[model samples]
Target: MNPIDPQLPPGDPLVMLGLLASAILFAVGIVGFLSRRNMITMFLCTELMFQGAGLAMISYGRQHMDLSGQVFVIFILTVAAAEAALALGLVVLLYRRKETLSAEAWKELAES
Candidate 1:
């Protein structure tokens, strides 16, 4: 016998809530990434988007009684870590050369 009731639909209240939360998070991340001029803040906004994605994956995995979403979340975590490290390195280099975290400083580097 199947563990999950085949009669049950995927659009249950719990899943709907999770999906809505993820959408909101992604929207906030997009807004923050667009509105912020600081390099660090922009990178953090990207991370926020990743978090929303991870949460959505987990929720969907649970809804389907599958493990793939959890596995994908692990991959997402790995990528997020790598991105953080690279962003930090870039921020340090940019700060050293321009003494500022504002992304506009990058333009000066190209012009000079």
Candidate 2:
């Protein structure tokens, strides 16, 4: 019987490492999103989630030899940029109103 090679090829190792990093980033983002009450921390967690998604997409693209995954990553980056802009605007508005950046202090809205 022939034994399979224990060492992974270069591509395989890179894919495995990317997947592991994505998983860790996802886990940490989830934890931060749930545990933090600050708006900035929540925003950071969202960015982390975006990063993990991008990593997974890039890894899959490499494995498949396709450009679609990279295109998707580009779209994700665009969306993340928009999200950051909007979030910062809202944070500024909130700070102006409450003089604080805590999530708990953002209960009232301009309409109410």
Instruction: Return the top candidate by TM-score.
Output: 1
Candidate 2 deviant stretches above 4 angstroms: 1-11, 107-112
Error of 2 at 21 (Å): 0.7
On a 0 to 100 scale, what is the lDDT of residue 81 in model 2? 99
Model 1, residue 20: C-alpha shift (Å): 0.8
Candidate 1, poorest ten consecutive residues by summed lDDT: 103-112
Q: Per-residue lDDT tens digits of candidate 2, residues 1-112?
A: 9666769544577877887888889889999998898888899999999999999898888788899989999999999999999998998898898888788775665466
Give one digit per residue, the lDDT tens place, for model 1 in 10-67: 5567877887788888889999999999999999999989988988998898889899
Q: After superposition, how far is residue 112 of candidate 2 from its true place, in Å?
A: 15
- For model 1, what is the error of residue 74's alpha carbon versus the real structure, in angstroms, after optimal superposition? 0.4
The local distance difference test score of model 2 is 0.87
Weakest lDDT window of 10 consecutive positions for candidate 2 = 2-11
Q: For every candidate structure, what is the RMSD over all alpha carbons to the true structure, in angstroms?
A: 5.9, 4.8
